[model samples]
Target chain A: MNKHLTVALDAMGGDEAPAIVVHGAEIARERFPEARFLFFGRESEIKPLLDASPALAQVSTLIHTDDVVSSEDKPARALRRGRKSSMALAIEAVKAGDADVAVSAGNTGALMALAKFILRTLPSIDRPALASLLPTYKGECVMLDLGANVECDASNLVEFSVMGAAFARTVLGLQRPKLSLLNIGVEELKGNEEVKEAAEILRNSDLPLEFAGFIEGDMIGAGSADVVVTDGFTGNVALKTAEGTARLIGSLVRDAFQSSTRAKLGYLMARRGLDGLRSHLDPNNHNGAVMLGLNGLVVKSHGGASISGFATAIGVAIDMARHNLIHLITQDLGGVFMGQSVEDEAPLSNPDKEASSR
Target chain B: MNKHLTVALDAMGGDEAPAIVVHGAEIARERFPEARFLFFGRESEIKPLLDASPALAQVSTLIHTDDVVSSEDKPARALRRGRKSSMALAIEAVKAGDADVAVSAGNTGALMALAKFILRTLPSIDRPALASLLPTYKGECVMLDLGANVECDASNLVEFSVMGAAFARTVLGLQRPKLSLLNIGVEELKGNEEVKEAAEILRNSDLPLEFAGFIEGDMIGAGSADVVVTDGFTGNVALKTAEGTARLIGSLVRDAFQSSTRAKLGYLMARRGLDGLRSHLDPNNHNGAVMLGLNGLVVKSHGGASISGFATAIGVAIDMARHNLIHLITQDLGGVFMGQSVEDEAPLSNPDKEASSR
Candidate 1:
């Protein structure tokens, strides 16, 4: 058995709510036998689901919370009114050092707001950006600031690069990850001032990262870098567009195979190969968005994710906590900050600052 | 036969040079029997290719030029020193009323700089944006500012929406195309200041375009809107990411089919369906990117595009010329401008003005 790592869960969050949340925890518990869980939500709803999974019930403690934050609630309103809500309480467990990490399948804006407010950011970190694992031709790559900050300046981008590198090292297990700035073109003269400036800084930085220079969006799926950094606006759009394209192609492929009787028979013959392809591209297999630069580790799973997907998200949080991701990130950021003591002070109201309020 | 439309070709541009340009024009000649061509390049190189196609030679005039803008040349350098280059002459042909449109497969930055200098912007237009046809669930949609201007304000986005609508009407043959601002989220509170402002303006505009409100990037391939508008940086990233995702899936599908003998046999049986999918996703089928908001039409073909791809680009130019796209764009802008006369005077130098110089 391994060291016990407690994970706080927002039981009332997500589309499926306490049912999938408790069932996913059961699946996770079987995978990680030493892990313990704290389920926060209405006891009446969660007790029944938790009771169904005796294995998870054995290692879990139920904490009742009547208040639940709706998906439609704004971040600011959620922060003000959701102090004792299920989502807030889970994050508070991490803040109080009662849990190693917090995992939620809830509203993204509400989760971010509560986590930031309760846990606060690291001393050297200005803002926390969302980082997630993306499958690529080579294997997997990490992309940051997915939708956390809309308009990032050069410094904010530089910070994202630092945080992204740390997250890649912890999650992807790369000793020296190559980082690249996302832009329209690879040329130094291309893109806006912020992209160009961030490129220059990364190119000359004294950090341990291998700066791969500017990489266009097309190069992302090619696995040109271990870490891809961009402002939240562009990163979010690129990420979503890729997902939409994948879905479109998947549906089109299915339609083609079902178009005729011969095609259907062919699909049956190729079922094994198709299964492999599906397993490789399945969203449930890779389902976690790590909130980096925070004092404690917090993972936001997709609200509409199935039990399997939620389990995968818990797996991600377990890995991050085991590897001490928060400590590693803080150390990396401290080194970068010390190396650039001569530069101007970090901006108080950077891109991510506006994101919380918006 | 349709009315004869003259198209000036930059014979020295593209990876394949005069060979692909001359050959593609021949293919276009077969499709559009009334089209005339003006080939600008070295007389020695282009003469042989032109002679090889007796039909294209019959309706074509070869204009010799010693200077050829290299693909490596920067936009500013190209603009200053490529006055007599093949690319420059092609745009000049349109400005001189010798050709209805110009088409090239050259350095994008160089083409934009030279075309903007030679053709100039329309009286009501502040900048020219690159608009192209993207395949979606519902046929195809038009996306603008692929890489023309980076940092767009609300005004720039509004102008892009107008231009995109006009382009869709002319090229996609839509009566009242549904337009939407490309954003991180569909909510009014999502994204940055510029996106919110643009959505507000588009929602209240008196133009004929159907303002479909905000659309997230993931909704792009779902055919949610006929025209998607955004700043150059985000649009460029999203477009390229979609292309990359398509390529990734294509390679993965091939790998899956080749993994086993049964899969290979299945692929053979499903050849008819696979072929349909192949033809649908072929880049050559959707080739040209029209530079809109300029006084004259200029289409940019992919640098590494095949002969068929180049032909598709020529077809796009011919369509734009036949429909008088420039006039329709001017009329659309006039409507939006008249409607917003009560607001502050339009800035002389918007985001695109800085892009040209940078």
Candidate 2:
């Protein structure tokens, strides 16, 4: 680990800013003792919290910024007018080489725009993708392009595959991670033109990743692949849908336990076992969403994440910085593109004609 | 209820076709005593099963058709070459007015293709959408188009809203169902061109259904809206993702209860309450997916559904037929379009430009 590794924090972002940010940083400091912190927010609001944690205060530098990117602000507006906002300043810190990474829990659109504008994407990447780890039955898996690019073409999906595989290697520590394109069906002939075209290219190419064929949404939680790739729109919907379902089941279980005295007693006796299940499925255990393909590391925590969740996001940012995720992505791109532009690759000669028939 | 409502069954479809099909018919007979059955498959394979259920045999007419559409057959291939298959014959029965509705536990692509070709679409409908009821915290909600149309234009989505609203009215008996377009965010400026355009049209038009504006995927399971609409690819992924999450939770719950002897005793005491939860989340309770906007009612059951699951599918078909789902959709479409075609409606002058910026 770099002794002087620094992380910039958007302390004025998120639903419960400053407090969560300060407490989260303190928690993260214990895990990554060598890491330094740069807090950007209203000094008046953050100083008292920082003072409470003397150790964190000693290693942290607070930069005052009253300007904040509001939750309702449009991305364009945020990018144009939020130059002095905490979110923007934190990202700028990364660009200025003061901080190795930036972590925010602000509005997703605003965060993406600022990160892209400040950090810029790697030379080989057209658009950076939002990649996150989701809990599966067999531990966890990484899914990419989660609301980053709503409409992705063949080349864009191929780029996501490379970036996603690189992310898995850095975070999940899986070498030659098995990847699959998210589709409606597992059949080779299913899905739209873009997915079918992307699959054809990946199948023929000698990319360093294992291109497992198309996977259905139902198989995602079964850990069918290490990396699941899709256009932003579908990925976003799928991810949110999974979260919603988990909440629904949790609510139903609570209702069931309260239905009868016997069930209530059962819940008491089974509390320990259920607690393990709860922790395993908790969002705090997996909170970081990295914007892959960016030149500098940028992690987005959930807007409503607790202190622990925010700390987990910080840990993710530190891990990416330590592993050199950007370098890894560039290397993976070099292996496949091989001095040729993505557009220069041969187009699919015969895309699946029957895809749109139904 | 129609005293002579007849349903055509594709007896050769599904993983365990002949037995599940025959047993499912017996179960449906108990619910809808007025409904008759026309079984289309090989009489030799189906006779013994039908004979075992004497009551179902009394109401069912076995029609011999040796040919069957395989699950692997492409939709286009099935449309061209599967005219004599059991799936085709069953849909033909609906086209010939021999049955009020057609129910099939078969390959979705093949079933959709055969239904579209044989039964045809309504005059005002460009493409039929696949709609299904999903269990939610508040009863159930309807979602579409679950892989019927991979890519949909603004007009197609508008048409789906009308069709979905009608389906909700028929099945859920809501006078003015709350409808929402599934997108990544609930903001007015979020999502792609087609979704934004469709939302604008729905907002401005005097459609019978209550337009509840945009909804995120996480709100779907909370029953935030009565009808949820999206393009086929996204809708399909979201539905499967929810199912996958539910199954994951179920597996986790089982593992938790079996972790210790005390937990096992708790499970024994809580078995009744847990059973209620299991039945509530069971796929068997919601097995049918209807091809909305077709001239005739066509319901597709899960290919791997058990006897009870297939029975639930038949129950769904009967409800649609009884409530006249086709006529309701025609009425809803007529009210909105009036004499003007969907294309003639003014297009979105200023679609959200920031949609693709990120």
Candidate 3:
């Protein structure tokens, strides 16, 4: 089954690309030996790196592309002028059925734009959302719309809930994912109109999803829900805030350990356990942000991620393709519950229109 | 200087009220010997606790009241029926000039509602905001609107920036506080309309504030700016997420230390330094979420806060009242830069209306 899977790579993307990309593919190839790859970038730059990885070279095809999308390029500019760029071509591979999934660690805006433009959104999805795994006390949870579609309507939120549930089921291997809307408070009447309306829809809907009601930010780490759905703005802020807090705590821990001679000795004794803790909290262990709602799967690795991180992202793509996440989402969206007329749906662009009408 | 200050206490507020509030007052009294207090709540419950602390009792006057607002009480109900309640009476002390500031660890929604209705808002401010100090690597930063106004316009955010700057100057003791609007991206064109418009106003304004442009959530702990401003919804989520992350990391560290005999020994050796770190990051040490923009000073402590936390909140109230934060904000608002006509101001209620008007 893995032999049929083809992963497309945007080799010219990220801060340290082609080299890290090839090395990471080598690591992924070792773990997923049956998977094949199509590398999209300049042949001169990518060929040498692939040659260094004999095993990766054996299972990969180098698709030459001279044009590259700069990290500084705006999403609009990238879309209009980057038709031949490595990132665009890589996404095209997924659209053309040459690859089961496409992965990039390039400019997030450009990737989202190109992916949305070329692959298009799923029939039931108005816009694609960025979803990533967050390590929670109970295990892990998925949060969506990390930085896509900042202003979302109730219908858009409901769509995100559906997408998040599918993602949790596929990636987290959950029987039935409990989904919650991220809000200022867990109370029914709290938060803005969009969240309240979305909750109302979810609570009343006959969808297969387990509607877990509203959840506060503190509950994200407490593992209150399998999937947390939010507008891009809140999700982005929460995700980054969590990251910043983690980093601050980590530095504080190190500072404490180095404050005294006794603490230095303690550090030596606790080095092994500390290493375990570090690895557990490492972003590389949880790499791969899947852009859900697209017609085809497109996984994004962190631009500054290491070989291990990139390999983890590849693993996510492999799992997603194997599980047929898109198929499951389509099937779920096509169900009897989703056959309700568009009048019940709110346009994400004009959320206030719904508010006024309601 | 504190001789003129009198703090109003909602003696029945908080999870462990009466006992905790009384104890906290004693602690604050010891810290600020010149400060006096007017405690509002049932005299039967508070008299004994105050009697235990003779020093606090000498400086305190008990205002008997049988009514108490429960944590579950809605804001509207709290405002309408809580006139004789402890929380309301405590706020009334500030309004009636009986206290320099009022401190409560009650239901945040109710406190805000009652405070807004009784205290009223400053002429330059359309809505109130919640501000709190967050520990960062470079020391500390002030973030606002923690959860006061759910939805804000561009003008409200600009106002928040002004308020947050004043807060940093007063509490954090910064000479020229660097202020930034919290956004998903730091780019000029990124984020929702409110944030983008707010950025434009700040960039063009001649306010004394060092408008540092947009900052993402991760920068909050990096000390990218002294003041971080955002709408209440996003700010609340980010703040909670940061707190949740901190707790998760703390637990993980403890788990690591207890994993093996060596780590246990390490924990013992590093106890002193770790204690210092703990105190620095402790919520009690940094307690106080001040409701800004109100005519009177009001500090809201966490309902679950300990005596130390409540004492810290009282300290914040004292500092704000002493520094004349509201006076400073009023002066700042009356400056030449704020003379721009109301046509430039965006309406908070109907954000979409502004979208079309522009």
Candidate 4:
């Protein structure tokens, strides 16, 4: 394991560009003194910010980029035209082994496309999955395929299970995570063909993980499993729905506290305790969403993330780089494909061919 | 429209069967003085419960049945063997015109299977959908296909949109509900083939309802649209995820209030305001999940519903019955199928044919 980690930052990305990137790297630097940064952005904007933070400037190498990928740019467009963009350059650094990992808070689609095109997928991985940590009753659980592939086949799901389990092991520090497929119902007969097929495959596999048959959406927050796996479409909807519900309840709580004079007084008295609860549910606390199954690590920070949130994303990349996430995923995938024929694995390697054949 | 409504109750269903049914009927009778009830269950158990409530007994007729559907029974097994069961009998009453609506708190899959088989789908409808109200920032919104159809085609999504819109109109009292398809993203080219196809069809159609394009899951709680439509699998997951998130936050709030003496004192002062918030977000307040697009109204109450929650389910059925929910759906579907040919519509009417063809 390399004690000195080098992280490439897309300095021009995110809602609050250079300022957030500069400040966030400084915070991350304080925590990880051995870690160095390569910032890719316009020299004019990043230089001023770096000048303000002498400590961050000392350990960071500023790489100038004339262009940046906008949030509105389609993945295809970004891939075709954003070669010299900060987001693309940061990913390129990882691909070229100049940096151990890349951290970005830019357009998700653009980042995903650029990362896939540059870093490429590992030999055993069919598709890369977007995995993130969600706050649950029993601390936090990891869920994957947030929005990477809209439609996933049985092979894709099986591949995701391996990658997600590997991620939980690396990030959550679990030796053998309890993994489950997300279905409409926990029953054996429930859900679509793809989910059922994946479950059957997992049940028969000799993987070194506890395969907790199936779990419903409600059980996700209750921490029924350490790793929750699903197709991107359902996973994306479930994740967003959870976010919306939390926000709705949060607003309602605020409204309640302001409804009456007594309530206002009560809120003042309970402010400290409520603040603790607030931080626990805060998105910034769980900001990093990693793109797993790639040849190199790429951690995506929320576009609207706070300074600490971006730092958390950098922290995720550091952990994965130090822990050898790519190597772990490669070894896990080898176990998955041991019993399968080469013909069964051919279609999943190329998504374009798979789509055209379908 | 029926001025005098008759509701059939599956008295053998739910966690606290006869007691919740009888007490709930007593409460419903107060709200709708002209409403009558038909209780189907074991004579010995229900006779004693009905005997305790004279007012409810006067307006209710107990129909003894020996069989009941267990919660663990699969849908196929329940349909094959539960012919004379309480849940089947309740649906039969609706089919026989002995009841305007049937309310059950039984196994959801069993209830859906029996209701679909007995009542059948309306002519223009392919499948019946499970519709429910969810609390949102701007009051409440209706979401459909909660777990009815696992994999829906483009036409099925269009049907859900019409049924969901009709539901919002009849129950929520909206003149022309703002309807939207649930997708991974709000963009036109964002989701899978089915969603994009449905959106294209809707954009070109002449339906009376407001087609607000696509909405992501997070927008569901923001009340971005009055009627949110999706396939059964995704819809079910989203609804449950929202429920789970709300419960998670609620528990955290309780923990915050109990953390210290000052927090406990603050909770006492804010008790009244917090009570109002609790009721606003209470599952009991939004208990009923209606099986929409059926020939007759069938409301499914939560198995763990309190007396008030069961009454709320009855209230929903009463509203649907009185407003002629079937007729509204029929009229709405007429607008939807105005342009399509008969050959294009044949595949949807029979789910068996649709599945076999697939």
User: What's the DockQ for every one of the candidates?
Assistant: 0.58, 0.45, 0.51, 0.52
- Ranked by DockQ, the better of candidates 1 and 2 is 1
Number of clashes in model 2? 0
Q: Taking the tens digit of each residue's C-alpha lDDT, what string does model 2 give over B1-358?
A: 5578899999998889988999999999999899899999999999999888899999999999989987777777777788999999999999999999999887787787777777777877777888999999999999999887788898889999999998898889899999999988777777788888999999998888999998888889888999999998899899888888888888888999999999998988888999999998898898899999788999989888889999999999998998888888888888877887654322222111100000
Error of 3 at B266 (Å): 0.7
Q: Which ten residues in a row have the lowest lDDT in candidate 4 chain A?
A: A349-358
lDDT of 4 by residue, A253-280 (tens): 8988998999998998888899988888
lDDT of 2 by residue, A122-239 (tens): 7767777889999999999999888877778988899999999988988889988999999987777777889989999999988878999998888898888999999988888898
Candidate 1, CAPRI quality class derived from DockQ: medium
Native A-B contacts reproduced, model 1? 0.67
Residue range B140-218, candidate 1, lDDT tens digits: 9999888878778898888888999988888778989999998876767777888899999888878778999988887
lDDT of candidate 3 over A121-167, digit per residue (tens): 78767777889998988889999878877788998898888888888
Cα lDDT of model 3 by residue, B61-103, tens digit: 9999999988777777776789999999999999999999999
Better of 1 and 3 by TM-score: 1
Restricted to chain B, the TM-score per model reads 0.94, 0.93, 0.93, 0.93
lDDT for B75 in candidate 3 is 77
Candidate 3 interface RMS: 7.5
Q: What is the Å distance of residue B38 in model 3 from its true position?
A: 1.2
| Model 4 regions lying over 4 Å from their true place | A342-358, B342-358
Decreasing DockQ order of the candidates: 1, 4, 3, 2
